[model samples]
Target: MNNHLLRAALDAAERGWHVFPLRPGSKRPALHGEERCPRTGECASGHRKWEERATTDPARIHRAWCGRPFNVGIATGPSGLLVIDLDMPKNNSSSDTPSGVTTFKALCERAGQRVPTTRTVRTASGGMHLYFTAPPGVRLTNTAGTLAPLVDTRAGGGYVVAPGSITPGGSYVVVDDRPVAPLPGWLCEALQGPRRTPQPGPVPLATSASRYAAAALRNETQAVATAADGTRNHTLLRAARALGRLIATGDLTRAEVEEALSRAAAGNATQPERYYDDVIRRGLDWSIAHNSPRRPA
Candidate 1:
């Protein structure tokens, strides 16, 4: 038995952080999945997820860790922790792309603030996790590249591996052992700002607006027709915007563009017909507003 790991689990629970077991030398949870559930003991009622089973009880912690030297997994949601993960770039050779730490520091500078001192953990991969108490009544969820490149947040329905966990890559260790700080005001404001929606890309034209409008139309609409489930709406919206730009130059009528886009997007659109219409309407509206009306001479 690894006494060090056992102590680590107990220490996290002492801080009221809900704890669960992760597989030894790995970040994945050790909990049984729903498919493997036997409908007995903990699963008698139903399958309990790792988050639901996470506990702060010392006795349970001792019992779970006594047999194997399991790594610790903390349920950030139940613990009321919002962990900002500053990650390193996957391709280390890329000098042009900035790491999350660099971007996050720049963000703090822009907000006229400094990065808050908190209980920070250095992960096995050398990334840093800044632990903060989430604001009451605000349930933030996980994000991918939401703040900047290689930056992510773990909240409601997310988990983080605690310090003292070791993986094949390296060891998770405490770099700065300061007390977990409250979520900073600047970050809270940033999080609450207007959610940014995805915008369409640059307009497409193979040649002259009049001569190439039909070719452009065929290409864009064809893209929407073959778009798969998750990307279908985005494809439709982009096509609409590109075509709407042609409408602005009087190369294509709005009626024909709308009908062609709608027909192309019908089967593969993720939502109802009304949703497709709204996306098309907004995409076209945005393109028209940004472009000046002109008749091709």
Candidate 2:
């Protein structure tokens, strides 16, 4: 085993961060208990929820790092790290104004606060993981595209690749390497906003608008066809915009609908990455505007 990962693990432990050994070149755990093991039916390695095995114990850290050069993973909630993941455009675009940056700016405008400077990590894909200290009594859950398609969060049960970890794709490097800042009030409130949970008693019937919206979404997803190179973006945008309008009425959650849209867009002969920048992002933005709590008169 190379000393690099071992040294990184020890350093993380020294800093009081709960750490774990991810499989070499992969994010899955290196040591999974029997019941949840992925390698074999009998707990050889790779746990289902590997975050549970994370610890700050030096002895365990030594055992993991000593055996193999595993990638280091920091347990988010346990380590008090709330990460704001801003994924870059998939086309490998290096434009000064990327989709993630644009969306982040829009988010700040909506929230009325700027993101405080803190320890930021640049991921292998050129995206960013903005680290923040979780607030007391705030149980943040992992969410994808809740704020924007490219904006994700790593909270209580989530984990992030530590800065020193190397992967097959690339390395996770610290950009600022500064202390983690506190979760700003605006950002925290946005994350902790009221969720739509299933309540007891009879399930509310889907509204007519919602039913129509769902049917429209299903129809669009099923009808996705091969798109020509020039028309791919337009094709996906049309479908996503229609779905977004339905989503605006509370007919479906953004994640579920986006998944369907993604699968449909990836169908046949079309690539999903081609539509992310101009199609998917704009479609969702349209939905957010129409569905916002304060609807314009």
Candidate 3:
């Protein structure tokens, strides 16, 4: 067992993140297969989904790394994580900006906000993984280039190569030290697309109040980030309403939530401050009308 990989896996487990082994130098899950395994000749077992093999148990992790040093793979769904993958532009087009970075900036601007600097990992390809916790009851699916060109996501059923993991290109390096923030409602809805509504489930308590606020703002940023110009206001208003539910929980005050959301809305120059204020006020109003003072039974 490589002491480095063992330490990394143990650290991740300590943080409550589930992990698994990837082939020594590849992102593919290290599974046994009999058929010809392209990535690693050691595999004799058939193809396997990484999610199914991921685990939080310390013993299992120990077993996986006891003999060979493997790349660390973090399962996103079980770990309550939502990862924004920003890939560098493939070609040197007219613009210097990578499409992913441009699109991500556009998303934040549309939401009138700034993307939270949370736990970030720089990929070997000079890309980045923006780690955020998934909101209670929200299950985002894995996506590629759907949010914008070169922007991908690792949600439920997806696995992100961990920070300490090494690859042929380079190592996945952590760029930020902040804790993972929550996934905001706006971003959640946008990533969800026009698909079926997520079934109602228990809302998990957030790690902290500040993280909760960051999560809410992240959603607002996403909402604005992906929405078209003409419908931006309506989209923001809708996002404000979703945020209202968070305010209703009593962990966050109205002003605090509004301020966070306003920052996300600030990116849009055309929408006056008063417009965002009005939208926020209305959203809060809806929460006040519907939310009970007591927590749900």
Candidate 4:
């Protein structure tokens, strides 16, 4: 990636993208002579004496893995650091359109609270990453996760923001709160509104929507399982799927779902069995509520 692309990745990171340091030799156009690890700060594996000069500096290592000019950083507040990733939509042009910009602006306005410097990181797929410094006492988990439907932090505190990924024309902006950009009251209200929870109510499991929900639950089960093994990709994917299922079903109580999810993550029991139990219990409850004959006085 070029400087522009690197800057884009930075912007995306700021917006809560799960930025990972690429390993060397994984470069598409293989690094010719020498290489180094981006994270470990070590010489590239199996370097010959002739290749020493080619692979020593951090910049070269980053270039080798990233194949671009960028690094990922999170907004570490007085509390902790937040790692993020951008999940861009399939269409790339969405970022450059008016609606895209408006959405991006709205998200920044909502998150712009006592932030200072903003930096942009470019991504491999012609996108941008944005970063901003958080203020004292503000927690990344508190702000990033609660700001869902707009942004979310996965299990390990990484977030994936929409419309800001490598999708055509997708871009991110790091707004410095210290400068105090004028923001709409409604945007603030949306950001400050109480967090929404999954509603526990009777739902028609036989409908098309319920079928989709069941599939989603299965996907979530797989994701959680993969995450248990310490794989980043599956963990993030599972979290997203699970969140979608919760939104779609609207039948399982949030508390129950959360408890089930927590148990699944613990990996003490077989996930599929546990998941089946939870879903079946939910269905049984729904049936009891909907099908039971009314009591006569």
Two-way lDDT contest, 3 vs 4, winner? 3
Task: For model 2, give the 10-residue run with minimal summed lDDT.
Answer: 196-205
Q: What is residue 238's positional error in candidate 2, in angstroms?
A: 45
lDDT of each: 0.85, 0.74, 0.76, 0.38
Clashing pairs in 1: none
Instruction: Candidate 1: list runs displaced more than 4 Å.
Output: 195-297
lDDT of 4 by residue, 1-297 (tens): 444444544543444333333222131222233445343234335443211222223443345335544233222222123322233344655564433223455566677743223344444443333433333343334344344332323222333222222333334333322332222333334444644333223322333345556555455544554453346334533454454345434644444444444444444333455554454345435544554456799
Q: What order do you get sorting by TM-score, best first?
A: 1, 3, 2, 4
TM-score-superior candidate, 2 or 3: 3
Off by over 4 Å in 4: 1-21, 24-88, 92-100, 106-117, 142-156, 159-297
The TM-scores, one per candidate, come to 0.64, 0.58, 0.59, 0.26
Candidate 3 on 23-91: residue-level lDDT in tens?
998888786543634544222354455675677888888888999989899999988899999988776
Give the Cα error of residue 135 in candidate 1, in Å: 0.6
Stretch of 10 with least lDDT, candidate 3: 196-205
Q: What is every candidate's alpha-carbon RMSD to the true fold?
A: 11.1, 16.9, 16.9, 17.1
RMSD in angstroms, candidate 3?
16.9
Flag regions of model 2 displaced more than 4 Å.
33-49, 91-97, 194-297
User: Per-residue lDDT for 91-140 in model 1, tens only?
Assistant: 65578778789999988888788878999999888899999999998868
1 or 3: which has the higher TM-score?
A: 1
Best by lDDT: 1
